[model samples]
Target: MNCPLISLKAGAVIFTVLWTAWMMWWSGAYSTANLVILAVCGAAVGYVWYRAMRWQFERMGMLPHKDDRSAQ
Candidate 1:
């Protein structure tokens, strides 16, 4: 199977942005402190999610091998 076109960095960024936006909208009352906390938490969650998915995909051979220089 072809590897997914999205890179880890891109996936994390996309996830974080979407997550933060969704949370902000859901909360309905925004504050500077809330925005900052949401952004930071979103990024951290996104990174962790990316790593977990990457590991699973690699194990399943759905992602490029780490040592494959031409994979990227």
Candidate 2:
């Protein structure tokens, strides 16, 4: 619940679907280009989600490290 990564992942999925639907509707047709854009968006979202998860884990003292072991 405290992890932002989960929320971000959900957002990515929700937005990707919405964006893809909007784009598809606007174009009035589907094509390879649209699929490529969708892929790019998904990838970008995935990257952001990964970074956010790392940051959140670090902030929450959930990241693993020898030094961290002493702190806890």
The model with the greatest lDDT is 1
Least accurate 10 contiguous residues by lDDT in model 1: 1-10
Please provide, for model 1 over 1-72, each residue's C-alpha lDDT reduced to its tens digit, 9 standing for 90 to 100: 243736766887898899989999999879999999899999898988899888888788877667774655
TM-score of each: 0.75, 0.49
lDDT of 2 by residue, 1-72 (tens): 334546656776776677666666777756788778866876676567667766677777676544665787
CA lDDT of each candidate? 0.82, 0.66
Worst 10 residues of 2 by lDDT: 1-10
Candidate 2 has an lDDT of 0.66
lDDT of 2 at 32: 86
RMSD of 1: 3.8
Error of 1 at 59 (Å): 1.2
The Cα error of candidate 2 at residue 66, in Å, is: 11
